[model samples]
Target: MNKRIFLSAPHMGGNELNYIQEAFDANYIAPVGRNIDEFEKQIKEYTGAKYALAVSSGTAAIHLALRVLGIKDGDEVMASTFTFIGSVAPILYERCTPFFIDSDTASWNLDPNLLEEELSQRAATGKKQPKALIVTHLYGQCADIVRIQNICEHYGVHLIEDAAESLGATLNAQHTGTFGKLGIYSFNGNKIITTSGGGMLVSDDEALLSYARHLSTQARDDAPHYEHNEYGYNYRMSNITAGIGRGQMEVLSERIKRRREIFNLYQKELNIIEGLSFMPELPSSVGNRWLTTILLPVHLSPEKIRVTLEKENIESRPLWKPMHAQPLFRDAKGCINGTSDTFFKKGICLPSSSSMNNDDIQRILSLLKPLLNC
Candidate 1:
């Protein structure tokens, strides 16, 4: 048996323990501490956001963002159908009705054309439009955000970027998350960087973020005694986790570099194979390449390939099943095109951990080449 390879796994910088030790030394073990403050500051600086609030998870950040935006029962919220449930679950948490949009063939993110169609139809019917549009930067790739932003603005809808898998991604040298009203990042164990489990909500609007921070910490009114003015959630990131994020932030650029290198390596090696195509990279966007994904010809079974890789102790996974197809969202209204369904059927996520060296990459290729007949 060989060492198991993961599709995406935590890659820690050597300095994580130093920050953890500092947290211990300062006795900042709770969610509120210098580490938390510093982590939020670093995220703001990195993403060019005016404010950031660290929370327990990316889903929590989304929930807080929706709550701060005043989403309520029966309010419509539009989200990309081609994303993890984390991006859509928050809408339901806010008691908002979800309207899903399909993906563009090129960027594999939300399709702005479909978005316009949906919004235009809603406007024509004189019905209330979605309160917000949650655009996900899936697989670290930036969506056509400039176009999407224009559509959202035209429709008078707030945009929230789900940048969970795209922390270091940028478009025309601008960060992906900053173009929207609010954006969120994840630092889960399997993300580009990890804080074990944490997320950050960022925005240029300080008042909104201040309210979000208050709400995340149980929405207590300013008083010495325990008091609450409204509904709140225990969603703050703990100091210990923030310490991990602080150290991970120090090495984020390098991690992005390595991940991209991994993507390039995989493409260079496997793309020559018949029936295989790598995910397209847009010229204007620099993606974090969090996971190297490929599309196989219809004849090749992605599940079979995944099983073969698993047998070799290498972890591979099918691309996210479009949310519209999920049993949980079966009844959710969606503007449909066949793009996302096709992607779901043929795409596979390859091992792309930044810790993997060239040899590790070669090992994976060697195992796959025969199976793929490259």
Candidate 2:
């Protein structure tokens, strides 16, 4: 049997150990240290965000975003129905009502037209507008962000970008996360870059970022003695973890390059199949290609493909199930366009770890092509 091929394994750069060692030597084992500062700095500079706050996980960042934005219980928060659970879990944490929005065939992301319609209809009917919209950049591809941002502004809704899968993605040469009021990036084990498990919250608003920083660290009031005026979460990212992030940030461009290369390779190999389509990128946008996802024909079940890959000691998986279809969200209000539902059934996320080589890709195509009847 061959070595196990993973579905987006972490690929570490060589400088990680050096940064970790430096942190250790300074005895900065806690969450506060140079590493965290540097990590946040790099993220802010790279994404063109004015400020950034490192937290325990991407979910924590989203929660903090909600807290800082003053979105509380019973507030309606709109979200992409086609995203991973982490993107919407924060809405639940805040005891807010979630309104799911379906994806579009063009970008496989939150539909801007639907969003505009919902907002306009609500306005005409004198219904309360949702406080915010949490739109996920699915599989690292940029959503129609500029148009979405315009819609959100016109509707007086806050935009919280769930860029967890799209750290390096950009639209019209502008980073995806910077377009929204708040944006988050994940450093989970399987992300394009990893610090084992961490997340960063970014925003152009300094006050919001500062308040988020305060809330992230248990909302402690500034004083020499231990003090707290309001409730908060212990969401700080450890210095040790930040060291890994600093190193990873250094290699992010390279990682995105490799991931895109891998995607192109898959496209070249798999486009020969009669009934397959790769995830599309919107014009004027460059996605990180965090994972190479494809839609399979009705005859080629994603489950069957995943199982066959697993049998070969290779890893693969299906795309996210629409949040509206989930049992928890069964009663939630949504623009039910059936696009995301269709994608959920037919999509497969192929192994796209930057560590994977051309040979690994060919091996995958060899197994997949037969099942696809190419």
Candidate 3:
């Protein structure tokens, strides 16, 4: 059998071990170490954020962001319905009511029009409006952030950009994560870059981030002995993982370039297939192209293609099922237009690892051409 192809997997740069060794040599093995501080600095410099906090996971960052934003029990929070649960789980953690916004066809992200409508309707009805809007940049593509930000500002709601899949994505020369009040990035093993498992929270508000840092480290107050005045969480990223992140940052641009190249190859090879279409990339936005996704014909099953790929030691996956469709979130209020539902039914994520070479791409294409009848 050939090497197993992945949907998306970590491609390490050569410097990861050096940073790890430095951490070990310095004996900074805990979460609070030079590596963590350096990792945060690197992220802030890359994202143009005034502050950055290294956290245990992207989900932890979201939860901390919500807490910092004053989200509480029964407060309304809006999120993209088509994203991974990590984007919405934090709202639930705060015991907030989640209102899901449908996806826009162009970006496969939160629809700004629906958001405006939801906010307007809520305001008109004299009901409590959402306290925060969590917008996800799905599949490494920036959402229509300019318009969404305008809407959030008009409604007096905070915007939290979930850029876990869009670390290198930019729109109109602005980074996706920087467009919102607070943003997050993930460095999970399968992301474009990996720190084994870690995440970062970024913002222009230093005070807010300082509070987040305090809360993330068990909310210990300034004292000589162990003390805490508020509930807190152990969500800080460990020095070892932050060391990996520091090294990954060194080659982030190269990784983004390679991933985009992979997307281009897949687009060139597969776009000609009948009954298949690649995800649309907006002209003004440069996506990291985390996974090259395609829409299959209604008659075809993404599961069948996924199974076929699996038989050949390749990994493929169906697109995210909308939160509204999930049994767990079935009761959540959503402005439904069936866009996410349609996407879930027909969308397929192809092998898009940055480590893949042309030969690997050709092999996958050869197998897919017949199945798709291109």
**lDDT for every model?**
0.92, 0.95, 0.91
> Looking at model 1, how many pairs of residues clash?
0
For residues 30-108, what per-residue lDDT tens digits would candidate 3 score against the true structure?
A: 9888889998998888888889999999999999999999899999998999999999999888999998999989988
Compared with the true structure, model 3 gives a TM-score of 0.98
What is the per-residue lDDT of model 2 for residues 44-132, given as tens digits with 9 covering 90 to 100? 99999999999999999999999999999999999999999999988999999999999998899999999999999999999999999
**Pairs of colliding residues, candidate 1:** none
> What is residue 256's positional error in candidate 2, in angstroms?
0.6
lDDT (Cα, 0-100) at 133 in candidate 2? 98
TM-score of 1: 0.98
Model 2 earns a TM-score of: 0.99
The whole-model C-alpha lDDT of candidate 3 against the native structure comes to 0.91
Whose TM-score is greatest here?
2
Candidate 2, overall lDDT? 0.95
lDDT of 1 by residue, 162-210 (tens): 9999999999888988999999999999999999999999999989999
Worst 10 residues of 1 by lDDT: 274-283
